[model samples]
Target: MTFPTIPPMHRDLDFNGPLSDERAARLIHSLGPLKGHHVVDLGCGWAELLLRTLATEPEATGFGIDLGEENIRHGRAGAEARGLADQVELEVGDAGAWKGEASDVVFNVGATHVWGGDPVVHTENALTALADLTRPGGRVLFGECFWKRPPTAEEITAMAVIPRDQYRPMPDLVDFALSHGFRLYSLSEATVDEWDTFENGNAWGLEDWIRDNPDSPDFDEVVRLTDAHRRLRLYGRDVLGFAYLTLLRV
Candidate 1:
């Protein structure tokens, strides 16, 4: 099945945007041997994290897959700009249906949530699909939504982007990984610094877009979500959080 494509213009196109590379690096490094190894980044987007990996590990080669043609083109162009074109590549395809040789790591950041709102199904599909691409002892880097302390009423409303009952806690997902032949290697919560930064950066000018242009369901949803996010920032700081997980294939 063909997945919908999200262009760079319509999508968030910033590196680390609000995430700190200095912080995420330690988590990334824990999945070592990336150098001189092939790695596939699922839902690659603009390839910011992949670019960072390419820069850090001189011997590493990268394959970045996304549903968007523009993201692929832009990513390829970025690789060229970095003088790492030969070591980096891109493809447009659905992550669940994609099949290939096992790469060193099947990685994603802020992508697990973009699977059309069904995280359980989406995660299973990813696991089944990615299993084909992961050699024994390989790993998958998942950076996704997580509960901090407890969900507040406002946080529940904001997270209504997905069903409240369907909400899967971070540890729950880690359990899912362990059950499906993937072992949890590391887990870390997103601190206030990263969460606040990402939320604020992504929320910039969102209200203006909604007010100025009333006809965009595409952009309107983005604006609505951003508005709710701003509410959380103003009201529910301690109750909301995002975390990154690293899972190793058994």
Candidate 2:
């Protein structure tokens, strides 16, 4: 699965963006006994899932791959600082390639949706890659976003966001897995409280980011989107994203 061309995007302001290690733990609770296993965290932005796996599984090793070098650098540095240099490897590679030989379980905390808001076509390549790496009966954990219900015309027009059909619905992500020879394991819905909390708190480190790099090209866009998120969450919570966490097994 070749990763498609990525549009200009930035995770620099991701203070509360998407899934955290704390939240991911709850979603992946049933993965059970990672002893002597190999895991790949696809679209491993920041390497949260990989870092957590290495922390918990002393005998297991984890791999993190992403197209963004900045995210990879952060992941590598974190792993090194945690003394997980040996058990964790953060490489700059395409998530769509299943270069690794064997994997017991593969997971992505939150990168699934951002790569492509839709679950079927754009995300299929990532799923194929994960499945290829996993052993028979292996699991794939996808932590992504989706609507609580279909989008309303007014909602999209107001937010200036993509339409619901443009993104794969939550139910479709599961169907995509099954069609690819994978079976459903579990699906965890991120609550309204969860979405609101993360969406609102993403401004945590943004002020410092601005002070440090005010002249950067993406600085303004980052600020703009962040501000937009704050307003939308506070005022328009029901119209947009109600993300979730789900897992599948090959």
**Which candidate tops TM-score?**
1
| Regions more than 4 Å wrong, model 1 | 1-13, 16-18, 113-117, 150-154, 205-236
Candidate 2, overall lDDT? 0.64
Off by over 4 Å in 2: 1-17, 20-22, 113-120, 204-236, 239-248
Candidate 1 lowest-lDDT run of ten:
1-10
Candidate 2 residue lDDT tens string, 1-250: 3332222233433322455446667655667678888888877777766677668878988888888787788778878888999998888877665366757888765565434535444566556655676788777776555666675666666555454454566777568667777777777666566665565455545655666777777777767866765655654467445344445564
Residue pair clashes in candidate 1 = 36-59, 102-133
Most lDDT-accurate candidate: 1
Q: Each model's RMSD to truth, in Å?
A: 4.4, 5.6
